[model samples]
Target: MTISRRILLASPVLAMATPASAQGDWPSRTIRIIVPAPGGAGTADNLARIFAQEMEKRLPQRVIIENRGGAAGNVGATAAARAAPDGYTILWTWAGTMATNPAMYSDMPFDPQRDFVPVVLLGSVPNILIVNNDFPAQSLAEFTAYAKANPGAINHGTTGNGSSMHLAAELYGQRSGTRLTHVPYAAPAAATTDLIAGRIQAMFNLVTGAQPLVTGGRARALAVLSPERVPQLPDVPTAAELGMPGLAFGTWFCLMLPRGADPAIVSRLNALANEVLADPEARRRLEGAGMALDGGGTPERLAQYLREEMASHAELVRISGAKVN
Candidate 1:
């Protein structure tokens, strides 16, 4: 056969092999998933580790996590956004970092929509209206009645302005015609500690984080700020069921790739995430930890979810007057 004929035959084969070869070689080294929160029990960090462990089982490469926690998740998000979009580096973050931060802060380092491509929404934890066991109110009715009588006398603790807790309380106040005095804390732990000490009257805490407090008799959940009751706290009725359907709030998390990541890698990781979340053991652990797993949708869904959350949170910020800056 002529050399030209041989080259033509080889061209198509090379094209096909090149893509396969690239996909195979992609994870040649360790893959790192960046958790934009603290490690050692931080929800995002813990969740990231779960996925990383499962991803390692599937991929030939090792999957590791790097916790870059600080500045309300902006520090880590910025780092991930600036990293090369070659799939080796990724960002596993939550609503606070992507949706709330942009609305809260005027000087954000990265644009969530422009700088990252979503892989999937991991899950969410509902914010529960928790109060110290010593507080007078027992139900939403009693709570709102007490707040209305007291006006801004009730001190509600939050991590900071525009945090899930703060905005949730603000939303409740807006809908219920009651008022709360916002007290900011450096972290949720501190706020919870203060609540336990009776230094704060109430807080909108994540169901998982508030579980032990409720069970231990340190605090009690008045209502779960979700449309439906969560498995973590099955006994707690949803705000909707309590006749305040609009008083819903929660934080969702997602896996995101730095912008321009390989489409093949996005698909592969999204598939792996779905598999990991679907695992009986993983699901049990995550659900037990307060997450409602929703891991299988397309990346586009996550992107759309992010947009919707941004708009919602922007309105929350407006109503709550929450400004981190």
Candidate 2:
């Protein structure tokens, strides 16, 4: 038979095996991942880097990260949601963005529940309540006493309303039964600058953002909002250890693709991501940036976790009255 006639005869066999074969080695093209934050060596950026490095080794093509930062991550997320649902474009962002942004703005371009599919849960880190070294309170106990005595007299800086730092400080005040004025900023760097200048008395800052301030001696490390003390900062105690256990919460970043992405493709990407999270060298860089490796489960588990967190954060906002508008 002629070559064309033979190929036509074999077409049925090729079609039957295509689905099974694709599952064996998916991601046959370059993947573009997006970060909904500024371009920097921040915690979330570091995570995207680590994952990209490991994923590039196993996949047929490379993974790239595009930083699209604005409106506290809404811009990038919206862009990712609008991209093709071919599993090539992924969005990796902090859990706070997923949980808090809906409450901040009246309209969002993408629906967190409907537009995306979870890949995995990255590790979590706690925020640090820091003050300029010149401030009087030396410890969590002392700080609480001072704040209680001077309710609303102390002003604290947060990334913005509905940000993790804002909710954290609000939760700290409510749980400790203290009052402090809030001053919101567009970015953490600005808040850090003001905290260093002693314009603000204190701030609930992410460990990554506060590391330089504390090391530079511009800010005092009071208490961390974690269940236990972090290994890196063994000297600093957790808020629970200092009598504010309820203030403890870990901020996390997670990987997600557009909804309706092929299951085979998602599985391939998830496997590579887990391999990345398990790498020791990668883990070190991420941990230094204040993130932990959370390579534990299937996408279903992460989806459930997201739902529960949404409810939990909603209650937190309701009780704290921490609305952005």
Candidate 3:
């Protein structure tokens, strides 16, 4: 049988799967995955590379990642949104691009729901509450008591005003009924530097980024901002476990295709992605980097998750009064 015919027949149940002719020898050439974030050791970039590497092993064609970071992931997201609906180009972005950006930015470049179709939820990483070694608070309880007693005396640093880290901290303060000051930095690295120097008393940074500081003893991890403790920081308790279930928050990465992509391609890509994520090695690598593996079931499930997250983040933006035009 022809390659196209075989792919079409690969799944008999997915009647909506695009016919071979529609996709036109799908994946005939190299595929590009656009990361709507900076090119660095950040979770998004690292995870994208890992996904690409794993995908390469399964697919016949090469998969390449392009970094187009700027404007809180707006630049790359918009580019991906406007790209041809063909499956060749897909977007690999996180909560900032799909959920937070909608509520945080007034002039959003792309409407995530309208512009793209969810392919899979790559994984999630919780933000750990880290404080300088010199800080008196060694645990979440201690920090809460200290902050409540001195309300506003403790200052926390975040990547930016509306960044995920900022929201995580804000959410914590709101739930815990503490009034901590926010000190926005140009980037997490800058914030980390200030944190080590004791310029800021606390921060809720991604575990992947904050792990080194905690491990090196430059900072102390008080708690993880998730329902469950991460394997990377086995000793640290989750916010939920520490009596602040409402403080559960984290950044989740996902893959999406421009809207109107061929159904067959979507199904094929989703299956391939699930296969990659299910690989023990892939899970180990991602988890070691502080990622919580997400069981990527289907495009519809991902879309529902995105919708729920957007609503939650919208509420956060409203309460925090974070806006960027």
Candidate 4:
């Protein structure tokens, strides 16, 4: 054979070997995790920080978290979606950004289903129905009765117009046949402050955020928004046990990479994440923050879970008539 023909035959083998060789040294440089929310004491932010700390130990390179909080987490999510699908930039976001925002916002910058690949679902925590200490009702039953008796008199506070807290409260009202006037706040801390000060009658907040107040006697937890009671609040009844089965709801945190990322990298990240979650100290810290600890399985499982959540949130959005431009 001619020398040129032999060289041509060798080129095909080199081309086939390029991709595998490239994926072998993945994450050699620093990896960035874009958290689509502001840096604060929020559960989502804490979860991101914890996971980053654990992942850096497991991975070869440093993992950094960047808070791009604005437009209801769209700013960061859009940035992540547009990032190169090279596994260097991953999006660590919660339910609002991935599952609920698409249904709540009319104009989303990127489609969650189309632009991202699920890595793993880190954890979840239920919402707790809390009221100011001086509120007349002491339990879920009394609270419902009070709400029904005084139709629009009871005021409920939420993080924002289309936040998970807002939708969960709406679902609670719809299922329990209670009427509540919603008062939206810029942040949950603000709402929490008002709840403790008796400015707002009641609020549905995450267990992680509300647990301290409930334990300190500043606020009272009427019911937990989970199918079964959470361990942190063993005395509190779930919405299902209180005759409001539809009110079972919570927020979940997840990690994802931009679409077209290498499948090998995706699998590696998933395995590493599950490994971090398996650590006893990590699980203790996360669970102490009220997380249910759902370290996800296969990437396909995360995809399916996202789909189910999207559909469920769509119905809630429709019922609550919530929308953002």
Candidate 5:
């Protein structure tokens, strides 16, 4: 598969019909996965499209992806939250939408916990520390020391205030006891351009976004803020290996249903999701794109994970002071 084709699905289902099939032949018609982001090349859209593409091949009914982008995912999330609680409408989103947006925006339209039912976690992409090759630091250890020595010398580019990228950078700074000036961008592509042109000294870029640059020699990857090394960039060290376990940062993707979805349908979808996620090809493609398919499949696990992530993101947002409105 091509690099774009090998990436993870919209963020990240289905099984058969013992009990869930009884629900008026659930999924008798088209099932739509609502991706709360713009369509095209980004992680949110590609992940959703490819995921649905794979599932569509097996499902008896058609599986389609719907893009609803704006307001940093609030627009699409609200649309999902308001959608009918039928089995057909599934919300495909990530930690930024489900976990961090609440902390960033004051008038969030939907409560991630209250308005939706957890379906399954798709995957996660860790934020790896990358610096311009021209910068002084060559390794994570040296980078931290340099940041400490020159508190405001480093300029770290991020997608925007309170974005997953910004939060990861804040977490890294907090854990490393170093300071960095924030250079927030409207999008990661622009920030990436700036990083390459020496406009910014560093970035806590997602592994998917950072891998090619590191491999192409545009940037030097120092450490991944994850528990383990990603398949796409195995040569980079992890934060734990660098003795900075507290810097662990990742943006996990998940699937959810609008509130009031039928229990039987939920069960059916969850089962199918588990089966699809466990497939070796799915794992290979997702992992190859720097996404780890280690997300817990059960709804109970997803709920607990959401709660934990929300709490962690809240703290990080407070520390970063990245309010959206």
Candidate 6:
């Protein structure tokens, strides 16, 4: 064959090899999944454990989970962003870090959209609006009435600034037309301690965060944030049932990787996550803890959700005038 014909034949083969070359054998080494929250928390720990176990079974190498908490999840998220984008390090975090932090803080070292690619939406849980059992109100309606009568006299607790707990409480006040006093803490553990001690009368916190207190009669969950009552708290009504249609809210967690990671690797991670979420045993464990798996659409959908949330919460934060250092 002539030299030109030989060169043409090799061009297609070279082009085909390029993609295979770029997509090199992924998970050739151990992968680190960074949990922005501490290891003890149900959402972070559960997801990390489940995914790591399943990924180990499916992938070529082991997956490890590391806890890096502080600064409302910024410390760990920032660390994940700075890590190499070779699919070795992943950031598994809740919505507070990606959706609410930008509006609350002036300087976050990494941008949620710019610095990372969404792998999959792991799960979401409806937070319950609860108060110490000794508080005056018995239900959400009563609580609203009491707050309106007292105005800024009622102090409420939340996990921290820019958390779902914080924003949910703000939304409740905004809709109810009451200016409830907000007390922010570093984490739910501290806030729960205060709630049990009667230091704060109310909190719109995670079910897992307040489950013990509620079960033990230390606090009363008067209303849930979902449209329907959670199975765990059958007696409590939803916010929508109390004449509030637009007040539905939930806390969600997702896995994200630094931008520029290979698409093949992202796909592999998401697929492994979906399998873990689909497992009947895993689903039972998660739901038993008040969390539900949300293994849905592509990473693009998650990115869109973040953008919409950023826009939606920006307006609310401006109106609420909630600020943090």
lDDT of 5 by residue, 95-186 (tens): 88988999999988999988988888777878889999899888888998999999989999998888877898888888888899999998
lDDT score at residue 120, model 1, on the 0-100 scale: 77
Per-candidate TM vs. native? Answer: 0.90, 0.88, 0.92, 0.90, 0.92, 0.87
Error of 4 at 135 (Å): 1.5
Q: Which residue pairs clash within candidate 4?
A: none
Give each model's clash number. Answer: 0, 0, 1, 0, 8, 0
Query: Could you tell which candidate, 4 or 6, scores higher by TM-score?
Result: 4
Structure candidate 6, residue pairs in collision = none
Residue-pair clashes, model 1: 0
Tens-digit lDDT string for candidate 4 (285-315): 7787677875456666667677778877788
Per-residue lDDT tens digits of candidate 6, residues 195-214? 88899999988766766778
Error of 1 at 126 (Å): 1.0
User: Each candidate: what lDDT?
Assistant: 0.81, 0.74, 0.82, 0.80, 0.82, 0.74
Local distance difference test, candidate 2: 0.74
Candidate 3 residue spans exceeding 4 A from truth: 1-24
> How large is the C-alpha RMSD of every model relative to the true structure?
10.2, 10.8, 6.7, 10.4, 5.6, 10.1
Clash pairs of candidate 1? Answer: none
